[model samples]
Target: MCTPNDTAVLHAIFNPSAPFGDIREDKDSNIQEDPDLDSRFPADLLEAVLKLELNGVTAAESGDVKTAVQKFTEAITLLPERPSAYNNRAQALRLQGDVTGALQDLNHAVELSNGKGIAGCQALVQRGLILRLNGDDEGAREDFQRAAQLGSDFARQQLVVLNPYAALCNRMLRDMVQKLREPDTQDC
Candidate 1:
């Protein structure tokens, strides 16, 4: 029952070539510039992080939440500033019923990205889901709106669901159109 949007999200998450594009571009203007911050990572650290992240994804997909969390934690320890590990760990935490931990990780992920990158968008969507589950529809709507602005189709879909007026109007319009289309029900 995976929708097209679900497929697209999976593709985006698994596609290595998809450019996340300079997450630091939105950094605070007052911060001292460090030219080395933009430099490429040491090859060994990069490889380790990639491996750890992949392992985390695999464990999560296999329903091993604890293992996934451990792997993601390792990756985060290795690169504390990397948002993807925090975002991925949040998923595992949520699956394990650690909603508070998930929210904290998601918050960190969003902050690390300055709410301007793929990781931030993903974290926002995840947080929206959590908020909806916690019966905070308004908060969920706000998160979805922000995530939608950042190009998350999943968030856009959630926005449609959260908008009761839109749903009601759509349903009413469909019923009316259907009635008009019915030859016997339509008044000539």
Candidate 2:
């Protein structure tokens, strides 16, 4: 079951720079766009793969997870060595309730991208969420840490969530601020 907190976290992971959800098309966007990946493929092949990816994304947005998976799989078939298709397929599989398949695809995406690009960051965040949901904070933290090093603010947030010390400190700070804001009414 998806809780409000989970939804907020999902939003954070997907749109870290747009906390209020007004996504801007600025250069410093939340999700990293990999120009190297685009340059690696020939123009025609890249165009075809991009079209399939766009279709996959559209299907996913429409809640047609199976069709999204199919489109992503077709893209993967066209470029087996690329990681973006695997990342997209992982998301569709996760939505389809195939957690195992999603994890496998996420792993493949991270591996194919050498954990250094957009696919790697997104895959790491997705995988970390799964691991966190499964009660594996350590594993999730590892993934989030790597993704944070790769410049993901959302991953940095996850790392804070996974750290008990940080949570305690945050709570303590909040309480301190609250007390300062509203001191005891008793006469001194």
Candidate 3:
């Protein structure tokens, strides 16, 4: 069982710079831009949300989780329907040892994205990590599976780690190594 501290270590291991997850660059071609979403939100409100979200990401990267959370909260207030703020805030909350809060924010993020966009995929992956750390293997697996289907490489890697067959193979290999190391009892 991984403790919260262990989870933090794992985050650093998986992504050193961002820890929780890397901030998606705005110009990344891989991320789909929803014209409908753009049309729905007012330009000023969208700008505010984007600015606050970027500030939150910067704060998170600088290890100022509280500040990150505050920024994200402001972004969410500006555009509650946007998933990015919630998703980013979830990461900050998780790092700050607020797992329940993080989970709530992630849930909101997933809901806002309708489990379809890049934001949703990131939220799923983050939630899956939280579930895994909390010892909810089945739930974690489900989230990872969904995120993988949404084309998240991080989720795909997590799936490999969570695969029972891979774990069993590793265990068997360890056992074989241990047996080989033991002194033979039979006479030569």
Q: What TM-score number comes out for model 1?
A: 0.76
lDDT of each: 0.77, 0.82, 0.80
* Candidates 2 and 3, the one with greater TM-score: 2
Q: What is the lDDT of residue 66 in candidate 1?
A: 95
Model 2 scores a TM of 0.83
TM-score of each: 0.76, 0.83, 0.75
Candidate 1: regions farther than 4 A off: 1-40, 180-188
In terms of lDDT, which candidate is stronger, 1 or 3? 3
Quick one: ranking by TM-score, best first?
2, 1, 3
Residue lDDT tens for model 1, 1-188: 76655555555566532322211222321112335432466768867987998998888878888999999999999988878789989988988999999999999988987776577777888889999999999999998888878766567778998899989999999999987787564455
**Native-to-model Cα distance after best TM-score fit, residue 163 in candidate 3, in Å:** 1.3
Residue 150 local lDDT, model 2? 80
Between prediction 1 and prediction 2, the one with superior TM-score is: 2
Candidate 1, after superposition: displacement of residue 126 in Å? 0.4
Over 4 Å off in model 3, which ranges?
A: 1-33, 170-188
* Per-residue accuracy of model 3 over 14-117 as CA lDDT, tens digit each: 65544344333334324354667656899998998889988888888888889999999999888898888888898889889999999999999889888766
**Candidate 2: minimum summed lDDT over ten consecutive residues — where?**
16-25
Please give the RMSD to the true structure for each candidate, in Å: 7.1, 6.0, 6.7
Q: List the residue pairs that clash in candidate 3.
A: none
